[model samples]
Target chain A: MFSGSVWKNIAVLGIVALISGITVFTVHAITKGYIIKSESRYAKRFLFQVAPNANYTNDILTDTINIPKKYFSMLGIESGEIHLVKINGKLISIIVPSIAYDGYNGKIKILVGINLDGSIVSVRVVSHKETQELGDKMEVVKSDWILNFNKKSLNNLEPKSWKVKKYGGYFDQFTGATITPSAIIKQVHETLKYYEMDKSRIIKELDVFNEIKVSNNFEGGN
Target chain B: MYIRSYKSILNNGIWEENQGLILFLGLCPLIAVSNSVVKALGLSIATMFVLLFSNITISLIKKRVSGILKIPIFIIIIATFTTIIELFMKVFMYELYILLGIFIPLIIVNGLILNRAEIFACKNSVVKSAFDGLIFGMGFSAVLITLSAVREILSVGKIFINMDLLFGSAAVDWSITIFSEGYSFLLFMLPPGAFILLGFLIALKNLIDGKVNTLSGNERSSLKKETKRVRTTGPVA
Candidate 1:
């Protein structure tokens, strides 16, 4: 079998593939549950950060609505979850995570929390690959530039003002990195507009999401 | 195959054949993640896991691996171990996994692991290969940690800022800020800073090596170049 024959080569390859496949499968099986837990935990952390003051009685982590492609696609993301923030058994606000694809380096993930009246409660940059000092100014830790999105909504700002100040918009883009802030502003504005257009449906979608989760859990339990 | 003493193996890995410093292997990741001590240590541990497991498996199956199928087989084995490490880190050390990002998966192509498999692990016993992997990993990590420390101190005037991400909640206060806010040498945190620091580290390693050789009265020619180079055991083409 150690002979350098074509058949031996194939046999060795087959054995290697089988072993590697089994090893990978074992690891994936062992870590799948914990990985899912960490991901949901991370999402919940962002939820709390975006709407820190929202007195949500329910577990906002579990209460999620999947954004439809028509709305999410414009923001350069394939899909996203709208985490509903409920207070005193009543819906108060929603936290929406969106991606700005035109960012200078790449995609910039932003989470926007909007109040029941459609005004923004807060905005947080969950993740981005922007330039460290310049584009990273979008991060709350780096600068107060991100706070500009707070308390502002589509109704307050004219549609034309969605662009950065360099483009005659209200928001101030970082001095060296205009593309990142401009892209974020444009996409955040669009996300707000999309929410406004389907406000009723988006809110009602939460009930549907809850029902689906309940049924899925019931099916899995059986 | 000639069996070298364990002490010689350790010396070879740590000082003589250090993948990061001596051979200048894996410079890309060495600089990329070495900006922060915790991040470098996290990646180093991940690489160690991959190397250890890949070396053992490759050694165990070395006899069965035909000459023609060696490269593809080694690659599959290395990739499988890398995936295993990545998955484990994502589960237990989720924060570090996210911080290290693509570099975790990119460990398969680090060239260090594959080169070890082709050169040392494939020809050695399982125990020897495992030891080699561990020592080589430590050697590389030493360089990574040193470079990261230099960069972290110079760039931000802080040391161990986020130990909790790698350690735990109890280690949250491990961060040491040498300077207060509003002051930082920002250039050292950037890519160019990484290059400068790495250049100094490589030079330091060479200088030490040269001093040690001269003190021992050993001519450079006494060191076998063949021993330093990894001969190809893969497909000739």
Candidate 2:
């Protein structure tokens, strides 16, 4: 029986805490695998949105190239991944995940899929903390503003034309929300420039890695 | 202390002592997540699950716990259940898990859950406490869903939009557009709108209660008998 003594009360509290800790630990253990899978599935869903399923024959989710920390400044993200789109062993495009930290509210995460020819295949806002109704117009579900990025590249537009229309540029900004669109456009432009500069190096690295992987598979079979 | 009847407990939770409407507990999440129905529904279900389990656990251990240590123990139990629900949602309902975000973890601090554990669960039978938690949670959900429905419709001119976030892909078409494109009223999507709409809802509830009371008053007079009033304060009679 639990007594009115101080020690007994402490003991009861300790036991309750222990039981709760165990319960939570058990639940976490059971759900950990599924949680990771679901998270990756969510990330993959956005990747496919930027790089449509019809364009790529490879498993783009697994075919990601982790961007080195040194290139974080160029991508405007702390860390990033670029999913490769390949067909019959030939790399044709890549989806670059970029973040714009100057969103009206906070950072806006976007995925830009670009062809090897440097034109954009498509662009999708993966996540954002921008104001609702005004800044959220960038979403494909809400408006076609994001779709305007399709087929656009640095070559088609002069450096000045890349800014939102409010700032004498090609893209239209929401009536009350220039900051969010401007941030996204700047980040997308920067990501393209990063790709342009590093394209050859990334391809050479991928080719070498692929050759090693193929050789390892051959040896494993033998 | 006297034991409350099952019916009275249910009535107390659902209407007479509704947490959101009357008690006005847990208003933080009530205002924040109620901008959309799916988000409101997600938080409601998560809160209800925690409430039910925590109530049951508290009632079961009430006799063993001393007075001073009761609050901490109840909190630990509630937090444990909240974390468990968060993990479960992450695994199964990943989209909703992402949508609900911080509000799911914030369930531990919801005054409604802790209040029930302290006042009702600690003094009642486990079954009665569990039933109380269920009805109380339903009462809270009723207010949240209503508030969110009004907010969603007024702001976006749509109902059930993005139901798939909570109900999965099969519910993708469940949304119904009430107004044509570009007919949205932005005020209703903001937090200030929630406060104003919630005020109107409370007024409507009071009006309904007044009407019901008058109708019951006539019946009582005809019988010339004193009916037992639903106790809103003090020990159950």
Candidate 3:
């Protein structure tokens, strides 16, 4: 017990590190598949809520298009993924993950689903840090305020009508939390505008992507 | 190092040296996650898992490690168990994992786990250390669950409202609404409320301890002895 050599301490430390590292690695390897599956299942649950009407046979979790960094500011997100909903191999709708940087407490992440006609299928807040009793009404579990965005589109509402009623707009704002609703209204409007501007390019990219996937499967089958 | 009886060790963990109320260790996650019973329960189970395994592992290896190397070795073991629990939670309890967020990884830094490993587990047998871990974990969880229940009831006017987040769909209807909709006290949901409630809880515990002592007939002398014992920190006697 009196051996206090420096090398001994280092060797003991090394052995402990190696053993603990192996233990963690083994657990991670065992749970990796279930982790991935659970994550996808969670994502799919939200995706379906956003696009309930889409009769897509494809796996929408991986059917995603990455938004270019140039448009990040417009979408209020650092990075973005747009999930394409397909029915019988046809692009039916797209669920875009957007963020509202102007939320009362940091950002509010949402999934906005838009049909091919540019109308909103639905919108669901993925996560947010808004005030508990005030701004949190935006959550579907908390209130129906979020569902008010459904079936609305740019064609119907004037550009000025996008803001909350407090800002001289068509949408109603939470009495005690104007900023929360206004921020979401603005973000949803921007999401609609982004969908309109990128529709053609999005469809073209999907077509190219599907063709490559089909070709890859063809080669693998032979 | 000295050995303690199983009953004394259990009492030391759950009451005499209660990590939450007496030691005041790991208050960061306690305050952050105790707003909801489901969240508190999720973190409690995760922390208890890490603490139990880390204690057993450290006790098993204490003989080989000596001097300054012990702390780092203990940390590595604790972190390995924490990561394993985090991975399992992400796989099996996905919703709770998301709700708990960064706090799960932050379990590695929880002072309670490190304190147990250093002050008790390193000097004890594997079974004793495991018992210590389990009891201390229960002590901490008791505080968290109680705080969360009070907060949930006061702030949201409901108990177990989001039980499904932890127990799956079967618990969806387990919640009990004490007050009608829109009847909430927002203060209890905030951080300051946690501090206020925790203070009252400590006061109540002290009051109870005083009452028990007097009822046992030892009175003031035993109370003084108890405080003196708590004051003498470090490894158990």
Give all TM-scores, in the order shown.
Answer: 0.83, 0.90, 0.91
Query: Compared with the true structure, what per-residue lDDT tens digits does model 2 show for residues A1-222?
Result: 655687787888888889999999999998999999998898888788877457568888888787878779888888767889888778888998889998888879899999888889899998898878878999998999999898899999889998998789999988788999999999989989988987887888888998998999999999
The alpha-carbon root-mean-square deviation between model 1 and the true structure, to one decimal in Å, is 8.0
Candidate 2 residues lying further than 4 Å off, grouped into runs, are: A1-4, A55-58, A213-222, B218-237
Q: Residues A1-222, candidate 1: write the lDDT tens digits.
A: 455587667876887799789978987988899999988887777788777484678788887777777775765677777888887646788888888888888778888888878888888888888766557888886789988888898778999998898889999977777899888898888878877877889767666766887899999999
By lDDT, the candidates rank as 3, 2, 1
TM-score of every candidate's chain A: 0.77, 0.88, 0.89
lDDT of 3 by residue, A2-55 (tens): 465887887888888898889889989999999999999998888998875747
Model 2: docking quality category:
medium
The per-residue C-alpha lDDT of model 2 at residue B122 equals 92
Tell me the TM-score of model 1.
0.83
Q: What is the DockQ of candidate 3?
A: 0.77
Q: Which candidate leads the pack in DockQ?
A: 3
User: TM-score of the second chain in each model?
Assistant: 0.88, 0.90, 0.91
lDDT of 2 by residue, B1-237 (tens): 636898988888889999999999999999999999999999999999999999999999888886789889989999999999999889888988888789999999999999999888999999999998999999999999999999999998888989988888899999888989776787899999999999999999899999998887887765554332333332564
Candidate 2 CA-lDDT value: 0.89
